[model samples]
Target: MKLLFFVPLLVVALVASTFAQQASWRPVDTKILSPWAAEIDPANPHPEYPRPQMTREDWVNLNGLWNYALAPKGAGMPEAYAGEILVPFAIESALSGVGKTVGKDQELWYFREIEIDRSLRREKLLLHFGAVDWEAEVFVNGQSVGTHQGGYDPFYFDISEALQSGKTQSLAIRVWDPTDEGPQPRGKQVNEPRGIWYTPVTGIWQTVWLEAVPEHHIRSLKNTPDFDNKQIRVQADVAGATAGQRLRIRLLADGTPVGEQLVANQEEAVFMLDAPQVWSPENPFLYDLEVALMDGKKVVDQVNGYTALRKISTARDANGIQRMLLNNEFVFQYGPLDQGWWPDGLYTAPTEEALLFDIEKTLDMGFNMIRKHVKVEPARWYYHCDRMGVLVWQDMPSGDMGNRWESRPGVIGKGTEKDRTPESEAIFRKEWKAIMDANYNFPSIVVWVPFNEAWGQFDTEEIVEWTVDYDPSRLVNGASGGNYTLKGQIMDMHNYPDPVMPDPQIWGDQQVIVLGEYGGLGLPVDGHTWQEKDNWGYQSFKNETELQERYSRLIQDLKPLIPKGLSAAIYTQTTDVEVEVNGLMTYDREVIKFDPAFLRNKHQELYTIKIPMK
Candidate 1:
């Protein structure tokens, strides 16, 4: 990862200012105003524990400011330094302190210094990036440590060997992201921001930190809840350990130990509670977990975690119609279409508090569910959802569509569908499997959406079956909006500016009716928009009163459809993106747009109405 180069001092100073300008060193009008906003001290911002699910009291927080520079395509390391840009925000975002675009050609370089604690000399130190858009190369004190690709997944590298004692450790990173120009699994990020698409997020857009662990440490763990069997399956993947290492796992409920077991390296163990407490929106009970690596009688490494009890499946209701069952009963689902975006940070939130605020607002809006559209959030996000009692329907991020012409909409209602190439199909399948494997343990995620609006959609039947086989405990939405084959459990439809119900005849016997997306009421408040002109929505209104009136009307229209078998409905979105102004909240999350009281009343009305099975 080492790059050798030289740059004139004048050129370095010029580039430093340019980087700072692009990173939005001057605050914009649309910046989110929170109580904690002014307290973001570069020295101690986001000091809260990063991983809520797997808690370790001994770990350190390595967030805050970092030195940054933008290099031209194929440029080597610069001799001089650039100004400081906030760590974890993309260069294209306002919060990054650099709002410049990192195109397919250029590379974004980041350099930071960290002082290692003197007491942890014998421990192995690992550098972790929650996520870096596309690809990243790491260097520790001028020595190459590792490199990683894939934008939505977390990766780490052990840099203990590259460290020197009694000196500040210098960490350097080089990132290259093609975004929409490449065939990577980037969700909705495009070089040119447009309707429903967003500005490209390049370089580190998530938390970056360093952790010190023993030679034999807990690498990863998975918790799967089986409500029907009344057992939880726990799998541990220990790293830097010997083959015969024994790991002890203890399951606790309300701080009381329920079950304990010992397993060998990289093995799965089942722990049964005396009386399992099933997880649901009404009662979200999580069992505290503690796992320790042992060498005979001594504990080598330990980590704390938690798990919830829940079950998701399709079963016959009292009226014999297929419905989504949670904890063995039918519960109508309703939520917003969450497209994880921020005006300041783009992919990353300004801080962990900001991230939690979005989830909290979604719950406060009186909805119990959310369709996580195409983007995978950090583990902490899902942990918040689990703790806040919000159900999640996770979607696999779409891939490249080789035949763009065939995928584009032709007439007002007609569309072209083409057969996918074998290579494209194989790639899609591989990535989809990886996504499911990575997020399978979360109890809040009940449904797996394989395709959305027919993006790279092929072999629908096969993919749906594959999803079921990969994780049979959850429901499957074969296709979210269009090109439905009636293969999945939910018969989902999409309508904008108005609500629509699926044709019962096409989904009469097997599927439960659900409005996957509808009601995009947009109002772009001045000074809070990404761009002034061409700010569009599915249905735009001039003022908050009009938006609220239209929203209430839409809900009133959906009332009769409940009796006609509408089981669930997800409104257009939670917040607006770059040019798409249709959001309940503004892009910066500064304004709620509509009256909260009216919206909450409408939400309560929607939830209270019982759908007839017939």
Candidate 2:
């Protein structure tokens, strides 16, 4: 948490001109642009710290103008630089200044020069990437460092060995993304943008940076809260832990120390709290954590983070109907099917403020939960949710959409599974576990959604069983809006234009009943639509009045199901994506189709009702 040393004056003067040169570069003009695009400074695009949970003050942001080239897939490295592209923006995005698609046969290349301050590069220099599209191979000064796959998870390479013995170092990255051509976990991305699918995001689309750490520093932390025990269980993975080094953890409430623990070379540590405040939507309490690796009196490494104490489970109501219980209370969860997409940024939001807007707006609509449909947002999004008390249903981005799904009223059927190759299954398994582990510390996520509408559902019983066993902290919705396995904690149903719930007679005693998706009321704002014509929604509306009336009626119809056994419900979406105009807000986030106050008032009925828990 504290800077080890001060920056040299010579280094500051040297990098000032480099930042100016970087800022002078500009993005190419496009047909449409978001409001944040105009305020972007190439020198500091997404300059905020990428990882909030793991904070280190001394780090270099590698987001700026970078040399780029597109070559054949197996071409290795390009002989010549093609042009300059923005570091964090996707190559296909207009904000990148090179709106060119890298097809299945092509590989995208990025080159940049990094000025390393000798003072900051102490014992180890680590390069961190928030995310890269499909696959990325890193090179430092033409020396191959490492290769990483999976587009949605964070990865880092120890570039200390590859750094040259000079003030400046050359960094190059080669990437290959197949979009929908391969069976990777790409969420709704395609070469051809259509009704539900959007443009392909190739190459780097997230913040890249470099950090300095000790030789034996903490690599990652997994915090699990035990409300019953009134203590927090922490697992700290150290990169180069030595024999005598110990992990010291200090828990803080509002910056004041509450408890402390010192574990001897062990991976796990427990901190007891005097009076722990339970985390919920109403309280949203968070405790600061200071973790360090110490050798007696000297501190080797330290990082600051925060966590919350909460629990999610299921219980039966007075009528013997199963319902979702958050922290032992039967509070109904209702939220929109949040497809985290931006018109200007596509898969990436223009800024942190832009990304936080969706969550803030969701809460303003009086909804406490959000189903992040088939997309994983940056770590900061979950951090915001933790701080703001918004419950999340995190969905594993769907891939390998080559299966037939069967679902009918009053019938629970096992859908035909896709016969995917072993390689495909392995890829899915690896990425899903990585995603879960990466976000396990966040207390806001209440449910883990593995499959959505059976897009690539396979080995349903095994996958669900494994997922439930992997992290028993949160409830598992095996396949939201997909064929029900009736194995996990929730039996979900999908119905459009009206709210619907699973039959309580069949699944009420076993699993919680929920409306996975419903009420896609569409009203395309003329100027804010993705396309001029043929914009689509599940149910189309001509004006705001009609849309608002239909939405109110849907909620009105949904009230009766609460007595029957509806646990939760998800509306169509948070915002309009591409040509799909069913969002509460438009694609450009310019207008809210309904009055926020009126919608908030309508949503209150679902949350305020108290169903007796048996």
Residue-pair clashes per candidate, as listed? 6, 0
lDDT by residue for model 1 (220-296), tens: 88888878789998888888779768999999999999889999877877987668887888788889899999998
- How much lDDT does each candidate structure score? 0.75, 0.86
Q: Best by TM-score, which number?
A: 2
Native-vs-model 1 lDDT? 0.75
Model 2: residues with Cα > 4 Å off, grouped in runs? 1-31, 409-413
Worst 10 residues of 1 by lDDT: 405-414
Error of 2 at 412 (Å): 4.8
- Compose the digit string of candidate 2's lDDT tens values, residues 1-614: 11111233433354345445556454454534555555567777898888988798789899988999999989888889988998799988877878888989999999988899987678998899988989999999999999988988999999999988878999999999998998889999998988788899888988999999988988998899987788888778888788888989888999888888888654667877778888999999999889988998899999999888898988889989998988888888999999888776777887777888889889988999999999888898999999999999999988888888876654444577788889889999999999998899999999999999898888888999999999999999998878679778988888877876767987899999988888889988776787889999999999888888898899999999988899899999898988899999887676778888888999998877778878
Q: Model 2 reaches what TM-score against the true structure? A: 0.95
**Cα lDDT for residue 101, model 2?**
88
Per-candidate TM equals 0.88, 0.95
